[model samples]
Target: MSSSEVHLRSTIGGVSVEGQLHTLSVWFILALRLMMGLAFLQAGLSKLLGGEFNAAGYLANQPASNGSPLADLFVAMSEMPLFMEFVNVAVPWGQLCIGLGLLVGCLTRLAAFWGAFMMVLFYFGNWDVAHGYINGDFAYMLVFLSVAAFGAGRILGLDATIEQYDVGGQPLVERYPWTRYLLG
Candidate 1:
C-alpha cells in the first residue's frame, strides 16, 4: 500500500474523511444503537428516580396460575423479597451502563452483548404478554444480537481506530471471524 493509503487507514477512526462516509448498514447500526441506548437510559432514570418502577408489583400482578414460564419464574423470584430489591436496583444501573456504552461507541461489542442478554431477560419476563414474539423486547434483543455479530463499532466508532492496532488484528479476532463484518 502507498504511504497515503496507510495514513488514511490509520486515521479512519480519528477523523471522518471527506469521501469516506459510512455505508448504509453503518448508519442503520448507529440509529439502532442510539434508539436502544435512549430506551434503556429512560428506563434506568425512571427507576432511579423512583417513578413507579415496581418490578415486584408488576410480577405479583401477573397471573401465577396461567402456567406461563415467565410467570412461574416471576413467582419464584418474588418469593425472595431481598433478591427482588437487588434486581430492582441492579437492572436500572445495568441498563444505564449498557446504554451509555453503546451511545458513546465505547466497548460497542461488549455493550451489544450485554444489551442482548438484557433483552433475553426482558423477553422471558414478558413471555406471557405477547406469546413469545411480536414484542419490543424481542425486537430489541434481535437488534443487539445483530450488532454483536457484526461488531458495528468499527464502522464509525472508537473500535475502528482500535482495530488498526496489533491487538485488534490478533489471532483471536481472526478466529472469532465476526470482526471482519464490522470493518465496513
Candidate 2:
C-alpha cells in the first residue's frame, strides 16, 4: 500500500516486477548442476577412450535377450557394430557438452534433459537383467530428471539471462508450465 510498493508492482511487459537477492537454493542448484555435468562428462569420456568399455559384450550377455520383446530390439540395435562405434565416439562429446553447459550454467535445462534421456537408455539397457531396485543407473536418471525439473541452471546460469530478457510475454511459454520450471 505504500507508494514504493505500488511502483515496485508496476511492470512494462507483463512480467513480474520484483527482485530478490540470491539465497542458499541458488548455490545448491549450481553445485548440483556442476556435479551432474561432471558425472556425465566422465562417463562419456571413459566410453570414448575405450578404457575398459565393453557395452557390446555386456549387452550380449544380458539375460533379457532370452525371448523378451526388448531383447530383439536390443539385439538388432547392438548388432550394428558401426552404430556402437558411433555411439562410443558421440557419447563422449555429448558428455563434454553437457558437463560444460551444466558447470557454466549455460543451457542447463537442455543439457539436463539430454542427460536424463541418456540415463534412461542406460537404465533400461542394464536394469532389464538386474530385475531389482538396486540399480545405480536408475538413480542417476532420477537425478538428471530432478535437475531438469528444478531448472538448476537459472540459479546462476545463462538461462537466467534468457528468462529475464529473451522470453518476455511469450504465449508459447505460458501454455507449457514446465518451461517455467526449467527456466527457473
lDDT of every model, 2 decimals: 0.69, 0.67
Prediction 2 global C-alpha lDDT: 0.67
Best by lDDT: 1
At residue 1, candidate 1 shows an lDDT of 40
Q: Cα deviation in Å at residue 25, candidate 2?
A: 3.8
Candidate 1 C-alpha lDDT tens digits along 4-32? 22122334657765333334456777888
**Once model 1 is optimally superposed onto the true structure by TM-score, how far is the C-alpha of residue 105 displaced, in angstroms?**
1.1
| Candidate 1 RMSD computed on C-alpha atoms after optimal superposition onto the true structure | 9.5
lDDT tens digits by residue: candidate 2, 31-94: 7787898887776776667675545654555626443445656666667899877765556778
lDDT score of residue 61 within candidate 1: 52
The per-candidate count of clashes, in order, stands at 0, 0
Give the Å shift of residue 75 in candidate 1.
Answer: 1.1
